[model samples]
Target: MCRNWGGGPLLVVECESDVSFSGEENIGLYQSSQWAERGFCKQCGSHLFYKLKQNNQYFIPVGLFDNCEGLVFDHQVFIDEKPKYYCFANQTKNLTGAEVFAQFAPPE
Candidate 1:
């Protein structure tokens, strides 16, 4: 959510598993919404990840990685809420917020 990050879109890479941190104890978790939580560094307050409560899935910022030579720009979520002042040039599979919820929301 852009509003959460000082009115800027956060570019993130989604990971379902195999994510680890060096100083794991320093990361603080905040319940940002009913369905999601946000992780950040406790010391300097650097944004770490946005995690889904239902599945423990993590959406980590792309800038956090030391090596990003092989990453690809494939898909983007929450396309409908994108600000009019900016747009990405990548030809990505864009999904609106509702579409993302419909596809990933846990079963009742």
Candidate 2:
């Protein structure tokens, strides 16, 4: 829902597609019939995640974690598209739009 998202660090978790998370209250879920599902916390308006239904895999904003001690930064996608407002100090395999699609996009 937002671009050049929060200025703080974000944590992204990729898990097996069958996994799911349910919130007890103030939750929002949106989906398109065949591709993906999105969720958010309605009360606080926090973007929860984006899940690809075909694989049951989801991308979550890691800042949502209470404790993220084990997380590590490896590669970064859309590295070329990141706004000038932020920068990362760590060395990572930064990929541009074409590279990302080439590696992850399903064959056409």
Candidate 3:
């Protein structure tokens, strides 16, 4: 399990069969076509990253890092799915689905 932030390798976490969804829901503007693999902490059973199996990439919820020291989000995914209950006040880069794909998608 890796825990470094952006500009480095993405964090990878293993998932268990007994995963649970809290219904907290994620807020962002990007969605991958692949299924998200979920996992929980062995000791606390807390919610962890939703690993994207297709590219061996993991999307860790910002909440998981209680006291993140140097981790910075490169982009906010699925912002359209963001709930109306809360609002993000940060000044980080925000990218929509098409914008994200444009940069990440393979060249023609």
- For all predicted structures, in order, the TM-scores are 0.89, 0.72, 0.46
Which residue pairs in candidate 1 have backbone atoms (N, alpha carbon, C) closer than 3 angstroms, thus clashing? none
As a TM-score, model 2 comes out at 0.72
Sort the candidates on lDDT, descending order: 1, 2, 3
- After superposition, which runs of candidate 2 have C-alpha atoms over 4 Å from their true positions? 1-10, 24-26, 30-35
lDDT of 2 by residue, 1-108 (tens): 235344444457665565566764777887733456777888887878777665667788877779888887877887777778888888888888689667655556
| Cα-based lDDT for every prediction | 0.85, 0.69, 0.49
RMSD (CA, Å), each prediction: 1.5, 3.2, 11.4
Model 3: per-residue lDDT, tens digit, 1-98? 22222232343222333435464354222233344345455555554666554454555656665766766545554455545775556676666657
- Ten-residue stretch with the least lDDT total in model 2: 1-10
Query: Would you list the clashing residue pairs of candidate 3?
Result: 28-77, 28-78, 28-79, 29-77, 29-78, 29-79, 30-77, 30-78
- Native RMSD of candidate 2 (Å): 3.2
